[model samples]
Target: MSEDDEDFAGCRPLLFTIAYEILGSAADAEDVVQDSYLRWHAVRGKGIGHPRAYLVRTVTRQALNHLRAARRRREEYVGPWLPEPVRTAPDVSEDVVLAESVSMAMLLVLETLGPDERAVFVLREVFGYSHREVAGLVGRSEATVRQIAHRAREHVRARRKRFHHDPGTAREVVGRFLSAAGTGDVGTLMSLLAPGVVHVSDGGGLVSAARRPVAGRERVARFVAGVARRSAPGTRFDITSCNALPAVLFRVGDRIDQALVFEISGGLVHGMYAVGNPHKLGAAVTPRLLSRKGHETWKP
Candidate 1:
């Protein structure tokens, strides 16, 4: 690859990640990353003091702008909008910042902030950019950036739950829930949920799913179980890794249906996020999975 192409290649992951976190859509993030790369190419070898920082700045600004437009679209969204579930590698489980930042709960909290606040928080809090660097990237005074950072930090802190990563506990909880669900055992499923458990499903109007968050232990349990009982006769479920945590992947024939991710607290499941939006699933699922006929086989 040429030097400029090489530079873009080296920084692509960081750029895409920043965009994804800010916009909550891998598809939008990909567009932002590509736009940033083009800008980088145009200004390449122009005595840029640090290419990496420049790329970060470019990607962050692009993402923030995209986020502004996205907020408007979200107002018109047909159902509860969840962050696109991106497949994370195993090593992400060990990175505390990554694990916490990408969690469904955290992303939902981030959604509460303004575009600028989200950008500052992602750059200053999650990615560890200095206040001055973030100010330069977002074109705000360092003092202003610091103030925004503090506000954003507190906003997220107040809303986001502090989750202790317990992979062993998570795996066990997910396994038990899956077994209970597959057997259509509502009582067993209810026993596994926390008293104030919540279930959120994202279908993005392209498939079948709950339009609003299902709250309460008994309601959430039955919500999950009712869907479980409606699965196709030969539907198969597998325990797999998704978003750096143990999750259950449902499949029917060759089509990957959905990924059910559970959030555990103490010994019970506190939150369940079912991502059935074929658009959100992206290339991770087969073409068959996106078909309306396939999606009708079950719900979550």
Candidate 2:
């Protein structure tokens, strides 16, 4: 392979990873990565000192630009908007980081921030970029980057508490949620949710869903029950780990219709994010477990 090919091979994964972290859409991230590769090849012979950093910076800037435009598009969106789904490898470390960084609940909270604030927070907190590095990537002063990150942290904390549950606890809670929803057991579902739980659904105008967040346990419970009643017969609910956090995916005749990703605070369910947009559903790539279960035709 040529030097350009070698660089693309080495940098593509990292670039995609950074883009996904910023944009929260795998499709968009892939596009950003492809675009970055084009730029890389265009300047192949250029002397770049830190190739990894250069790629990361490029991808981040591209994602940031996309996000700025996306925000405007969302202003006229028909319904709720959710982040795209992300499939994960069944690994411990990756899952843990993903649960916190890419969870639907977290992504929704991130939408409240400006593009620059979101970029700064992800680069500094999720990717562990140094303040100086983040400053360079965002073209801001180091102190400004720190300030943006600090403010973003506070904003997230005020909206939802950190999820500190062990993996086992998360699995257990998600299992109960799946069982409750599948059985249409409103009582059980209510029992598991925190007193002031919130449910946010993003149908992106392609499907019918609440236009705004439904807050409070009773409202959320009623909505879940209504969905259960309307579910097509023989629909199956599976407890899967999305982004390394416990989540539930609903399958209708082998096609994934919706995914529920959540936030757990102090062992209680604080928030539930329902992503039903067909566009967003494309992120539900076939899991390895499905292939081993003798299932075919499952695609994201």
**Each model's C-alpha lDDT?**
0.79, 0.74
For each of the candidates, give the backbone clash count.
Answer: 0, 0
Winning candidate number (TM-score) = 1
lDDT, residue 17, candidate 1: 74
Task: Please give, for residues 1-300, the per-residue lDDT of candidate 2 as tens digits.
Answer: 986577567556556666776777877888898998888778756887666666677888999999888878888987777787665545623445544676666777888888998899888777777899999898899999889989988887787446666667777887877678767888888888899898988888887789899988778877888887888788877776665556778888868888887777667788888888878776665541110111112111
lDDT of 1 at 2: 92
Q: Across residues 1-300, which tens digit of lDDT does each residue of candidate 1 receive? A: 896676566566667778888888878998998998888889877988677777777888888888999999999887889887776655676767877887788888999999999999988888787899889899999999999999999999889887665788888888888888778888998888988888999888887899999999889878888998887789887776565556677888877788787788787888888988877776344211110011111111
Q: In candidate 1, list every pair of residues with a backbone clash.
A: none
Give me the overall lDDT of model 2: 0.74
TM-score of each: 0.90, 0.84
Instruction: Candidate 2: list runs displaced more than 4 Å.
Output: 1-7, 90-98, 141-147, 150-154, 157-160, 265-267, 287-300
Who wins the lDDT comparison?
1
